[model samples]
Target: MADFLGSVWWMIVSLGVLVTFHEFGHFWVARRCGVKVLRFSVGFGRPLWTRRDRHGTEFVVALLPLGGYVRMLDEREGNVHPAERAHAFNNKPVWQRIAIVAAGPVANVILCLALLWAMFMVGRADYSATLGPVQGMAASANLHPGDRITDVDGRPVQSWAEASIALTLAAMDRRDARVDVLGPEGDDRHATLPLGQLPAGFAEQRVPELAGLSWGFQQRQAIVAEVSTGSPADGVLMPGDRILAVDGQSVDSADQVEPLIAALGRRGGPGMVEVQREEDRLALELTPRQDASAPGGWRVGVAMSAGTAPAYDVRAQYGPLAAVPAAIREAGRMTADTLGMMKRLVTGNASLKNVSGPVGIARAANASAKRGVDWFLYFLAALSLGLAILNFLPIPILDGGHLLYYLIELVKGSPLSDRVMIAGQYVGLALLAGLMGLAFYNDILGQLPR
Candidate 1:
């Protein structure tokens, strides 16, 4: 219940801030263009709070905190007195009208850049890009344990977060990526990861996991957390037992325990499992059984949690002056990535599951907030960038649609017919409804256990 309430509250807060800023952009530009701003509202429905400025513009905080709008005096919407004719939006020059219409998305872009700058200045906590083990594609690429990824496709990555994104994008494009790595022995090397080799039907949602890479610092200890009844380890292992070795081979992480257990099955024998129980070290013999459900067709039925994650091993930090350029670079990269993803979606190269609705957003907002201010700021920046991208899409009923109409007016020397515009509104509404339904469906589907 607390989590549900937190999600709702944060979602409201997030939308409120972003929507207000967007509306203010339109209001500000319209005023500068000599258009009479009639109302500046954050959210819709009945007004919860309202105030009128000296310029006769009404400022309203409405009941629903979902979205907002800036209403300007327009001859099209209502009558305009002769004295106020000059202040009507419809009377403005085409260029000024374009600026007023475009300002909302432009504001979101500016906000995105500013938020990224603040996040960098505050230092973003992240996990190191150091590898613990390599499997499948990663192993095929010759990545070794303790090797740290320094760069991907000529782009330097400071953390696992950056590398994962770079690799995931490559995966979506079915392209190989060149990487620079620093080995644990202090030697530098270069390799190409065959990210394109993943099956076409593979889910991009699990890209990082199936990419056969695991971060070194993130590996859990070999302590058992659970034992399934009637399984190989049920009678032999307890929850607190820390597995020290399998068949006399020392184990460092829980990931190491599985392979050794599988080996015991192939060898057709019960194996000596060495463990540390509190202050005492003991050895016990246990057989690994074949189970179709277990990895490598073997099972011991011992479960382990990553357990109280370690402190962040990396940070993306920049000084005040340096953060400006860093923010610009980050925003540019994000924009390109977003555009690429949209293209992929259109081309059916990406899944519809990537489309997150309000539920997904609320959960993300809450999670980021819990992580830290820097993380929360980063999340907001990314969201703002998405908003900018979404609104800029040349679809009907959006700012881009209005901009498109203005462009057509610029070329043909007049506005589109009112009939055509109304038809476009209906088309846009249908597209938006379909998209919202898909997003909500994905959100619900994501909640179910895989």
Candidate 2:
């Protein structure tokens, strides 16, 4: 329940801020174009709060936090005074209409760029490649246990975070990732290390959990958080028991135990497990259960504790004039990525599961917020850019759809019939409803524990 409420809170705050800014864009642009805005709303449904401005626009906070809009006076809705018709949305010139319609999305993009620029200015912590100490078995053969990595390929790395990203991207298609290390002397040594492959059936499969490799900046000691009732770990393992090993493998850390458990495939099989409680070392043999949530793995139903490790030696970068351009570029890339994902969804290459409604978005917002203000702001910027792109898509009921109508009028040298426009509105509404349903379904499914 607490988790649910937290997620809800996150959703409300994120959507509210985004929607308000978006609507304000339309309001500001309409006023500039001499159009009268009837209302500027922060949400839909019954008004929770309302204030009429000097311009006769009713500013409102509504019951729903899902979305908001700015309503402009238009002759299409009713008979308009001859003097006011010039300022009416429907009576505006085609180019002026397009400008007003495009303003909201433009505002979102501007906000995203600003947020990203702020994030860049504030400084972020990152790991150095030398942070992780090489373990016994993996370290023994070619690389020493304490060797600190200084470079990848030929690029000299000042910190481990930079080196790790370079190595991972390089290793994506290569069989081996070349590592340059700083030896005990002031000498540089190079090693061509073979990359680990996915175990048989898991190849070609993309699971969200295993998509990226975590550079071992921190080691977590495995302590049992909860023992599922009637599970294999229930009688054998209690809460607070620190896992030591599985089979004959030495598991000194939580990170070590995961790979061993995954390799063993212990579902429904008698498996040996070793754990330490206080000063006592205990061992037990039990059959692990198959967890349906874990698609290609066995589970003993244990939760491992983990947290982000601080990167103390990371370098900071900042430039007053250059940051703005960098921010714009970064925002543009994120916008492109978001559009690509949307394209995948429309093309049937991606599942509806990729769609996230309010619930899913809130969870993401909350989690990102916990990471840091910078991360939260970065997410907000990306989301803003995405919103701008989505609203501009050529769909009925959106700003793009209105632009489409204007374009059609331009081409035909006349406006569309009222009946035809009404039909288009219905179609647009239906499409939006379908999309909302899919997004909500995805969000609900995502909430189930994995």
Candidate that scores best on lDDT: 1
Clashes of each: 0, 3
TM-score of each: 0.86, 0.68
What tens digits encode model 1's per-residue C-alpha lDDT throughout 1-450? 989888888888888878977888899899999999999999999999999999999999999998899999998998999999999998999999999999999999999999999999999998889998778888888898789999999888989888888888888889888989999899999988887888888878677678788888777889889999998888899999999999878887888888888888888889899999999999999999889888878998889756777789898899999999999999999998899999999998888889989999999989988899999899899988898889988888989889988999999999999999999889989999999999999999988998
Mark the 10 consecutive residues where model 2 has the least summed lDDT: 202-211
Among all windows of ten consecutive residues in candidate 1, which has the lowest summed lDDT?
200-209
What lDDT tens digits, residue by residue, belong to model 2 across residues 365-416?
9877776877788778878887898788778799878888888988998888
Candidate 2 local Cα displacement, residue 340, angstroms: 1.8
lDDT of model 1 at position 72: 91
Candidate No. with top TM-score: 1
Count of backbone collisions in candidate 2: 3
